[model samples]
Target: MGPTPSSSNDRSERRKRNAKTTIQSLEPDTLCMIFALLDFFDLVRCSAVCKYWNTIINKSKLLREFYAKQKQNSTEFSNKSTCSETSLKTYLEELAMEHHRVSLQEGLINIDQWKGHSVGFNQCRMKMGLILTGKGDKVMRLWSLESYKCVEEYAVPDTVPLVDFDFDESKIVGLVGTRICIWRRNGKRSIFPSNEGTFVKGLCMRYNDPEAVVGCEDGTARLFDMYSRKCSRIIRMRAGPVTCLCLSDDQLILSGSSLGSITVSGILSDQQVATLRSRITIGGIKTLCYNACSHLVFAGSTSGYTSCWDLRTMRSLWETRVSPNVVYSVQHLRSDKSTLVVGGIDGVLRTLDQNTGQVLASCVMEGNALSSSQNTYGATEKRKGRRLSEGTPIDSIPKSARPPITCLAVGMKKVVTAHNGRHIRLWKFNS
Candidate 1:
């Protein structure tokens, strides 16, 4: 009993009519609300579905309101200008060039070069700043960012080299071997004893609190009360070292490990709330960052990829292959959460869109070649090291080329990238 051709045609027409009627009856305000719930990438795809969707999305008032709300908490939209399309394009280009020129100076000597090697920046109270570096000097050097000069250099007793450093508004924290040191802004320094651990790999402070979290190479992440200098809680991992950690505004501690797993735990209860496994296996997780505005968590791998996960849903939002080499650092642009800057073993710095995983722009590092194993003194050492496949140099390659990037940090006005050649380049928007 097969249906006749006429009956089949009639059924098909009715289905089409029903769909059209449903779409036509949807209110513009309701459509706007629906779009708001979706991510930027999903919204873009929705707009292409039909003419009705396009009309709602193109409404100036709706788009303006959405962008304004995003700007309130995100730094990404702070620098955007509401000008004509052509004018906006021109402005962005000029801003990119300005950021590239001032921050990416090549073949020049740094005025305040120090002995030893790894360098980091810390925000200080009263508009002051600190820079920590290592070598045989065995000292932490504090610097003034306004004057671009060293203010104080505190010496450490032992010859143990600094493994990691972090700071907040009130104090500076440094980890040398297994011991953790806390120094107040007023110049008091004290070392806190920890159970036997080879290295402290990650450090982060809780938002709006004096408490901090530290991750070690022994697969354990612990929360420490900075005031009391006591371990408050500990979250253990399965295997591999805990490489990077970040604390959300709600006091949720997120940790990424070399075992290709990301775990989230509540600080107060010290309970494992959620966990996500990597889509692709890598050497280890190198860096992690959180964007509170979007509730997005980003994890970068030693294998050269960055993965984004939604904190609320505990599901992967998107993952993109950033570079061929290992990704060392990842930071969300304060002005725009949609934009993220990634530094990797491939000496080039890339800015990507969070929703679509599209690269916005890339800047290449042009300098002398340096070996990967070269540590503090830029000299080869025999210690255990992470390895990545070597890629072509930035200057000799095209704009789309990828090169290795060692470290990255975002500041109030600029984003800085540290290259293998002991080069630190800053990037900022021009307008």
Candidate 2:
């Protein structure tokens, strides 16, 4: 009998109580300093220790600034609330809880997939709960994001394939051959055709509400007024064919050419501002996107490199080879601009650090269907031609038949990837 049983139990309880107080006893500033050294996921885990830790982690301004790049004083947030200002912590909490069901840092799982088009899906865009997809068959289909059912379909002339398309809440616009095709969502009158611009053929387009900028095969960008259905201006890039276009609210137009040069021009001035040239001159620029918050512009090349340019100084920030072949798509999260996602011919999805161009994570698709428990979604119609591996093992499929990722769209915590085959994949990440 070294000690009575009751006495021993009391001693253990005292130790457990003291352990909780030990962390709470530290001054808030000291605790903040300790938490500052921890990474994002570590801090999230630490918050679950108790109420004290959770409150501190949520209230810390430093932590919010490190994780959430969104500005509290921005017009979108400030104009919304008339009584009180929205804090970064609240914004972060909303995004973490509502939007980001999974974390991209850890890894992604192929949870759901389906056949998106009869032919290959050439381009896609997602908004709200709807997805708009375009194919080389001159057909554009709109699908419900949740059901994976084709809600509506629009078609152009069979002779001309759909080049590129974009949609908002109101209407859908596409570059069909030499004209700008428009379809109003209300279905009052469909296919508002624009005046045929001087360009021979359109390669790509970006819509800025009432205005649409169409990049053409003639190395020229024609700005079209959507409301009036007229071509406003023709800005000459003088590079090869204009392959991609990015529009900014600051009245700047960035057009990437097949000749591997990106020309920045002002909308009002209608003159060339600057040119961004990548070190790899052989590959043409396939995609271009602008991040207004960071004043950064991203360009993906057919030569497998992705480059970033700072609009403030008009200088190249960083460039890194993301793929062995063409990088067809490049997109970043709206809430967090630090993580950049790239996909292309390699059939691999990669996440990169936008600031340094460092590869953070890579995920390869094998085209094997997961269990029904993992993914309940499947194509309603059977794929007509050569189907993706389906339940077949990766080792069985030939490397040459592997489908290239033609386009991709990021939504919340999930990523939807379209391929040269009929199938499209959905990947979800976990914290």
lDDT (Cα, 0-100) at 348 in candidate 2: 64
> Model 1: runs farther than 4 Å from truth?
1-137, 193-209, 365-395, 398-404, 420-423
What is the overall TM-score of model 2 with all chains considered together? 0.72
Candidate 2 lDDT tens digits, 194-256: 344435788888998999898888888888887777787888866678888998779999998
* Model 2, runs deviating above 4 Å: 1-84, 88-90, 93-102, 187-198, 279-282, 372-402
Q: How accurate locally, in lDDT, is each candidate?
A: 0.59, 0.73
- Per-residue accuracy of model 1 over 182-278 as CA lDDT, tens digit each: 7776788888755522335543323234665677666677666666767767777436667778888886888887677888888777678989776
Evaluate residue 289 in candidate 2 and report its C-alpha lDDT on the 0 to 100 scale. 87
How many clashes does each candidate structure show, in the order listed? 15, 0
Error of 1 at 312 (Å): 0.5
lDDT of 2 at 145: 74
